[model samples]
Target chain A: GEEVAQTPKHLVRGEGQKAKLYCAPIKGHSYVFWYQQVLKNEFKFLISFQNENVFDETGMPKERFSAKCLPNSPCSLEIQATKLEDSAVYFCASSQSTYGYTFGSGTRLTVV
Target chain B: LAKTTQPISMDSYEGQEVNITCSHNNIATNDYITWYQQFPSQGPRFIIQGYKTKVTNEVASLFIPADRKSSTLSLPRVSLSDTAVYYCLVGASTGGFKTIFGAGTRLFVKA
Candidate 1:
């Protein structure tokens, strides 16, 4: 079975500080996506990347959030000036094609 | 992408069949219905997907009627381990770059 790997299962940051989460797609997969789950609620799409290029980032907060996926390197989501509302579990997922997506356990960020 | 509606919660007994329904009245022709299951403190895992008619996998079965306005995910002989949050997503079948998720249904299986 293929698995998406994520680093730093837990992250704690002070408000107005910065936090970065990392994700590695399953071997041979090209598409990576980011989603946020707040209070164990719905999974909110943050961004999507096709290969090393960003396909869509409509859900991303441009002022404080950005993501990048470089070839042969794990993808990363960086958030600057974190707010209390930014506390949530950020998940990274990858798919060989567009049909199915495998998700990482996620990085839980707590902004204090 | 189409809006999906599902029950907020469901309760089932162990060893019984559990069926969760999702309604997507505005589904487009290129859209497909996909389901995912998530346990506590873990990310969602793909369960089953279907375009129309029926699709059955080792873990669950998906049934879609002719109208495609609604779909059902059927889990047979469910155990306690099957209890989790189930999400039904409707998105373009091919080259769908954007995916939207709904509130989903929380299933509780009891002994």
Candidate 2:
């Protein structure tokens, strides 16, 4: 596909419930990146994948945040136990070269 | 990754030309300057990118000096619909390197 595809436009989860988001990068793009945007600003990098392997996850919270990009499937970001502060818009982007990135409409996660 | 600095906010009238400048004093040789425009509830969209000199597209123009330490995004005759947050990113988006976004410039175009 020409544009990156993200599933579940909006999700509402309980404090302790698990929340999962999906992203399908553009075809032929080898890198997939996930970002968390809070309060309409402050974009925090969460994780990235080079194919099915984890590339850089330094920004990801070690305790409750985990992500995976498997073959023939859309990439997924999972939250073990959702917290109130976890409410934000989660964006996924795909890049092929040094040119630029193509971002998908993010998944809005609200934990009550 | 090279870090970029931009104005926190800017205001302009409709049908006015707006130029948003960004400074990346520590930019490296391989780093490229890219700009993204984001609306209130949408993801950031790639606007323009340049390595040096000037690059122009239908959307906007990107100008870079010889030093490559600073770049400007030129939006000609912007209207109210063009009002959005503009982000200046400095990095190599290739080789699995992530594109890090800095604090963007909030451009408010009013009638």
Candidate 3:
């Protein structure tokens, strides 16, 4: 079983600072997805990438959040001018099949 | 995209069989029902998926009736460690994968 790998299990940032997170999807999986889990315990879709192209980004907050997945590089999610409400867990998932999704351990971001 | 509805929370005793149902009234013809379990501070883990009829695997079993409007996930002899949030997702496979996770059903297993 392949696993998606996420770095920096925990992250802390001051308000107005920048925070970055990384994810390494499963080796052969072509689709990568990023989700944000806020305090309400809901998984909010942020963005998704198919290979090196952005497949969907409807859930992304364009003002302060951005993500990228490039060839031979791990996907990254960056937040500019972090706010207190930005504190939550970010999960990265990768899948080769439509129904089979493999998720990473996730990065817990805390903004103070 | 199909929307799914499920229970907000459920309680079960250890060693008991637990079944959680999800309703997807607007399920498209190409949509499939998938379930995922997530623990605190962790990512969601895939449990099972099905299009129609019954599909069983080592971890759980998914039962989809003829109408395909709803599905159930049956966990055999649950343990305390099974306490987690379960999410139901409905989506088609024609294009790139884009799943919508609704408010998950939280299951608390008692000892």
Candidate 4:
């Protein structure tokens, strides 16, 4: 079985501060995806990566949010100048193909 | 992108069968239908997937109609632990490979 690992299960930050979340995809998985779940709502796609290259960032907020998958390093999502609305459970998922996906437990972010 | 619509919620009892249906009228020819289950405070887990006809696994079964416009996920003999939100997704694989989830159906299994 494959598992995606997410760090900082819970995080509390002040508004306007910076928040960073990390995710380690399952070994041998080639595609990584980030999603945001707000207030128990549907998961919203944020960005996706193929290996170290970003394949799609259409769902990401261009100005304040950025994600990267460095060589041999776990993927990271960084949010600058966080707002109250930024509070949500961020999930990371990885898959080798289209049929199945393995997701991390998720990181809950609370901004006040 | 194929848009999916499912019931907002459903109720069932322990030892009973539960079937959740999803509709995707604009599904593409190459799109696949996948179902996922999510418990509170956790990520969605894959239940089953199907391209057409019927596919069954240990956890659940997926029945896709001939037109591919709709599909049903059947959970047999559900238990209290089966109470959670179930999401149905329809999408085509890109070079990046992404799956988009709709609002999903919430299943409440009573003991």
Candidate 5:
């Protein structure tokens, strides 16, 4: 029950191409979060949604990054005109009130 | 969001108890201290969390002082499989409840 599912375990896209990643939160969880990890460093929070509504998106790069968590569908993170710097692992997490987060296995995106 | 500082790395041997500490001096009243563990090429896993005093789970323990300035994650009887990067995060539910991750401490457990 504490499992967040992510699809496309690995993705390879050419520079300037578009990339999309999907995540399915645990059932009954209302909060979902997306994070980016690069070069085995710290995780950078990209965005979060509270019941399909944008809660905090301060970390999302406005230029080409966008996300949506729609009702009765999986959450998606899309990057347009992907850059080499954008190549990294994208992790999705879900949590309920006062409960700790459950993270997905992550999608490794390689932009060449 | 409260900033956290932790050791860059630590080394330990099997059967030893390892304690990794995190410092957050500017923690707010409602901020909660949380820890996560991450292995290579995988997503982070929640280890333990606490607001104040101490909290214990089957996997780990979280200890916070009265000042709420710092917290420590204690792992009992380490093994080689426990070697991973441990992250410390502090966030509040009042706001947007965004969790910010720090550099984290990489624990290398040697057999």
Candidate 6:
């Protein structure tokens, strides 16, 4: 497809529950990236994948956050035991070996 | 990764030329400057990118000096629709690298 597609436009979870978000990159793009936007600003890079392999994860929180980009499946970012601070919009972007990235509409995650 | 600095906010009337400048004093040799415009509740949209000198697109223009320490994004005759947060990023264009974003300039275009 032409655009990066994200599922579940919005998700609400209990503080101790789990939350999972999905992203399907553009058909030809080889890389996928996940970002968390807090306060409607401050985009925090979460992780990146180079064709189903983890590329960079330095920005991801160590304990409760995990992600995967598997072949023939959409990429997923999972948060375990979600906390209050976990309430934010999660964005997915796809790119090739170039400078620009095409982003999805994003999934709003709210932890109550 | 290169850090950038920009204004917190700026106000402009409609049909006015708006220029937002960014400073990346530590820009590396392989770095390219890129700009993105983000509206409320939407993802950032790529505007223009340049390594040096000038790059003009149908939407906006980018001007970079020889020093490569600073660059400006010029919007000709901006309308209310142009009001949004503009982000300046400097990084290696190797693609899919973890990008660093700073506090973007909030542009408020009024009528």
lDDT of 6 by residue, B6-106 (tens): 99999999999999999999999988898999988788888988999999999999999999999999999999999999999888665568878879999
How accurate locally is residue B52 in candidate 5, as Cα lDDT from 0 to 100? 97
Q: Candidate 4, after superposition: displacement of residue B66 in Å?
A: 0.8
Candidate 6 chain B lDDT trough over 10 residues, lowest sum: B92-101
lDDT of 2 by residue, A1-112 (tens): 6999998999999999999999999999999999999974889889889999999998899799999999999999999999999999999999887778899999999999
DockQ numbers for every candidate?
Answer: 0.66, 0.68, 0.61, 0.63, 0.59, 0.72
| Cα lDDT listed for each candidate | 0.91, 0.92, 0.90, 0.91, 0.92, 0.92
Q: Model 5 over residues B1-111: C-alpha lDDT tens digits?
A: 789999999999999999999999999998898899999878899888899999999999999999999999999999999999999999964334678899999999998
List model 2's recovered fraction of native interface contacts, to 2 decimals: 0.57
- Where model 3 places Cα greater than 4 Å from the true spot, the runs are B93-95
Candidate 3: residue A78 lDDT (0-100):
98
- On DockQ, the leading prediction is 6
Candidate 4 lDDT, A1-112, residue by residue in tens: 4689999999999999999999999988888999999864677889999999998899999899999998889999999999999999999998886667888999999999
- Report the Cα RMSD per candidate: 1.1, 1.2, 1.5, 1.2, 1.3, 1.0
Candidate 3 TM-score over all chains jointly: 0.95
Query: In terms of DockQ, which candidate is stronger, 1 or 5?
Result: 1
Work out the TM-score per prediction. 0.97, 0.96, 0.95, 0.97, 0.96, 0.97
Ranking of predictions according to DockQ: 6, 2, 1, 4, 3, 5
- Candidate 1 on B48-99: residue-level lDDT in tens? 8899999998999999999999999999999999999999999964442777
State which candidate, 3 or 6, has the greater lDDT: 6
Query: Please, what are the lDDT tens digits per residue for candidate 3 over residues A23-60?
Result: 99999888889999887677888998988899999999
iRMS values for every prediction: 1.8, 1.4, 1.9, 1.9, 2.1, 1.4
Q: Which candidate has the top score in lDDT?
A: 2
Model 4: per-residue Cα lDDT over B7-78, one tens digit each: 999999999999999999999998989999999988999898899999999999999999999999999999
The per-residue C-alpha lDDT of model 6 at residue B8 equals 90
DockQ of 2: 0.68
What tens-digit string does per-residue lDDT give for candidate 3 at B1-111?
A: 788899999999999999999999999988888999998878889898889999999989999999999999999999999999999999864345578888989999999
After superposing candidate 6 on the true structure, give the runs of residues whose Cα lies further than 4 Å from its correct spot.
none
Q: Against the true chain A, what TM-score does chain A of candidate 3 give?
A: 0.96
